[model samples]
Target chain A: MTNEIARPLFATALRLTRNRDDAEDLVQEALYRGFRSLSTFRKGSRFRAWMFRILHNVFINRVRRQQLAPRATDPADLAPSDHDHPIPDLRDIRELPEVADRHFDERVKAAVDSLPDAFRVPMVLFSLGALSYQEIADALEIPIGTVMSRLHRARRHLRTELADYAREHGLAPDPHAPEGAGS
Target chain B: MKCVEFRAQLFPYLDGELDEAATGTAAAHVADCADCAGRTAFERALEKRLQTALLADVGALDSVALVAAARRSPPLDSPTPASAVSSGVSSSSTGTSSSTRTGRPGHVLRFLTARRLLAVAAALLIAVQAAWFFCIPPFECSYLQAVERTVDAEGTPLRPGVVGPPLAERIEVTPEVLGYRLEGEATVVDLGLGETANSAVRARYAQNGEVVHVVWSDMGGAEPSFRRKREFDGRSWWVATENGHNLVAWMCPVTESLCTLVSELPEERLLDVADKLRAAER
Candidate 1:
């Protein structure tokens, strides 16, 4: 059970931290905290979601502490603010082409890693296919609508980022080129 | 559905979270409208690519080590004062002070009272007994013991129960009972000593380097308790992992006995085998 649960936690941690060492540390701390609070877990509930919630909280706390520790001398830095990123409407997601089935592994990773945390968390959790939208909402303590919105926006960002790759493979038409340019 | 409605439901539709009515409507819209279909295909492809990239190369973790570390760490509800002490120690180690502080003993000499000494001795005795009980060989639990016996004696001829008819005749399990050919015969496990030995039959199965042991016991109401309850193929099975082996226990409706399937396979595969056994029973 621990091994089965650890794999997803580790994957999510790796995505969040973007460093193997930090991911391991983050997972280790979350697991420790999870065990200590294991008594609070209700039976017959989704155990993976419960663990993900703990991992989410641990990661958020660690980020906040790291952000605060270096700027301890400034009182204004202690205020909490929503970590929302302004996403520009670059291209109609419908106009974007299908990503080639092969050899875009690194680019996809970079695209996902580059998303802001607010959008990235839901996208990563959704892509895992381990949790439903409701479960993701519960894990992150957000409304289900928010989860869907963030996921849609995140995909839009990814499509914009990968659109260039799609054009290079001739899978999508180049928007900047004039009509009949390729012919 | 209009394009606006389809767009609103696109993500949910792709995720399979939409209700049946909404799903049908979305499907119809995508089927008829080339633009919506293209967008749906694009989203599906992107999601697949993202899933593939994110899950790839997530190296294996040493679960045993992680579990050990979790056990060693302090509880979540530890007192705040403990943090102060820990921080002090950390600061001292990193600071420029090489000198260590030693506590001075109190002027008053207090010795352990007779009652306290006796209590200490009693605690030590109990600890020793526990250590001996767990550390002693052959102290394996009955379920694990049956697993070990079946795996160790693979390909051996079937053995009869000491006091009953042949073990194979007592249980209806066969090599192909689980929809596949297992490689071993059934053996009766003595649940007690001598004439009172309540017997249970265990059959071993191996395929593609995966081993499974199916044990049927008539020990009424002796079903092993597991925290996770899973419903597969319209029957409930109790699932648990013990000593790195997966165990699925369910009551066989046909034999009217508790049946346990044990294996080193992943839980999903083990559950598949259990479902097959259930189907055979019916």
Candidate 2:
């Protein structure tokens, strides 16, 4: 059952973990737990979401137990979008130099890496292009409102950063269009 | 909904998470509002680009092997083959129970057909047994053979009821019996008697001018009651104090011999001497 979604699941793990080795371990552990508790899986539910939920849970547990940074940092202090309101304008970004697709992808990864765990988790799950806001909320054990808020803040942060990269590469936002137009 | 509210609901509306009313309102607001429409479009494009950028190359992980491994091991929540057990047994009678049914009727038929014959046989057996054991009363439950306490002729209380010391003759010792040759002359004493009394044998071994008396006797299955006891090789040995000597005594279960070593040496040394003598015999 989990084999159907294994690659996408590993992709989710890789996105969340960043390190290839850690991602492999996370994927294996998630699959192990998924298959172990397969009987508990609801028949009509999505297996991908289920596997990702396990992966997210395992990763969060490992992070908390190891007292790793970002997770160990006060969750209350890291409340997504609670204090750090993103600037809404897309025009502040500079034009960027041309870069390869891999470079662009690496830039996106670096942008994700820059996000705090509280924002990063929901963002990664959202970007995985699979889980619903409710599913992300359920997976992260947070509220739907918190999920929306974190995602909104994450996208705003990404747009700002990526918009700057675009402009630095001479791919500036349309100057005559709306303030938050595509960069 | 206002443009600000529409902007706030942009991700929810794009993600299709808004309820019917909110979706309708947000969609209507975005459709009519150019700025909101452009913002939503940009956001949608960014989401698409994010997905493309973040889509991981996961071909390298061996998920097939992982799934196989998972299937091989029973789920932690699932009942393992090792742990599966029968829930119950049903007691419904099988064909094998015909013997029980057959036996039940035989007693009834015998009682009906031969009641007088059964009574005659029972009576004859009872009469014969009356002449055999119970009629004489010797074969009855009375314990006439039980040993009785006796006062010796010397007016001293004696344990005549004590079962035994076996009829062992005097024996000479090799140095192995003591594990060391005596520094002085050793004495072998025969303290055993015939069936008239419990029998015993003793060897007084002198080492470094210190005399240790080792006595072996047959206890005839009597439990050795000692004041101090310690366990050795899953058996108990008693250490008793008697006449300025410490006696470490134990029974050899195989030989049915109760052996005692009396030594003027301290309790530990006495036990050591007993242990060496036992080891040599082994």
Candidate 3:
């Protein structure tokens, strides 16, 4: 069962650290701690959520001990907008010709990596489909509303980052409109 | 639903987190409004692309390496401080101490003053006394001596009783058969019988407030001196009591190992356990 979790756990770690060696170290430490505390795991509970929670805690603790800069994005800034607006122009990415190109993947990764830890964590957990909004909230010790707001802003940031790529590929309708205009 | 309501529910609707009513209303709004339909399609495509990018090259991690690292890690429940764990991991990985990582002094100098030396002497004296009081095993002259050491007997006074004969049917003695669950892993204990120091496999079982210990060992031709003996099903069992504890010893027919069961249970229950304990492969 843990074998199945390795890939997604590594993927999440990589997204968080943005460095291969750090990601590997983070995963190894989390898995070690998880195995040692296996006795505390309650039966019939979601193992994915449990493991993800450990990984999240380990990453956060490491960041704190290193005294890295605090989260770049503020929670208030990530709040969902009250007014209605048109969505950003994002064409069906798979239908685009660049979808088959390796550059497309790199572009998406770079855009995701650009997000601050505050927004990036929820985005990675949600995009992995390993957790729900409630599970993300529980893992990050944030409210569900905060989870939703960060996810919304994370995607908004990614759309802005990739707007040039979308326009270059003719995926967007307006060529002259500024990127992230609707957002 | 209006465009405002559809926008509010858009992320949840796409994530399959919306209730039926909200999902249905969002779907209706998207169907009527071309712009809402495009936005929904764009969001779905964006999520799909994000998942693909995030999961790409996840096969790079070595599962075997990860498991090995985990196996090498110390138990989190140990008496070690939590900071020590992080420090240990860092030192193992980077060849550095906690002081190096945190830029703080890791050790302090201490002078053994007269008061400190006296305190150390007092601590050593107390430790020696505690060990003599608790670590010494009870002495028994008979073959029960070996059994006592196997059970780590504290010389509890056994009660005097005559246990009845075993039944004709012989079954293996297992936690399942005795309706008890094994508490933990079975441990190999040294019997310290003679020069050779024979070892026995001891397994403990508990149910509710009662606990039973079963020990299996090769007695090396030692015979029980207990007066009470019973024969049934082509085997004989020696039953004896020391202080308050009851013990039943018999040669297992299947494994040919001397199986001894010790508990504070009544004589009848001990015999019944002996009966059920025989005849199966060990």
Considering every candidate listed, which one attains the maximal TM-score?
A: 3
- Give candidate 1's error at residue B31 in angstroms: 4.6
Q: How well does each candidate superpose onto the true structure, as a TM-score?
A: 0.49, 0.47, 0.51
Give per-residue CA lDDT, model 3, range B90-126, as digits (tens). Answer: 4122212222222322311111232243344346444
Clashes of each: 0, 14, 7
Misplaced by over 4 Å in model 1 are A68-103, A168-171, A175-183, B31-39, B62-282
Please, what are the lDDT tens digits per residue for candidate 2 over residues B84-160? 11211111111111112223323444334333333443454444335322324322222112223322223344343
Proportion of native contacts present in model 1: 0.22
- CAPRI tier for the interface of model 2: incorrect
Model 1: per-residue Cα lDDT over A78-152, one tens digit each: 323213422222233334333443456667777878877777878777665256788889877778877877776
Global lDDT of each candidate? 0.50, 0.49, 0.53
User: Where does candidate 3 chain B have its weakest 10-residue lDDT segment?
Assistant: B161-170
What TM-score results for chain B when candidate 3 is compared with the true chain B?
A: 0.30
Task: Please give the lDDT score at residue B25 for candidate 2.
Answer: 83
> How accurate locally is residue B189 in candidate 2, as Cα lDDT from 0 to 100?
26
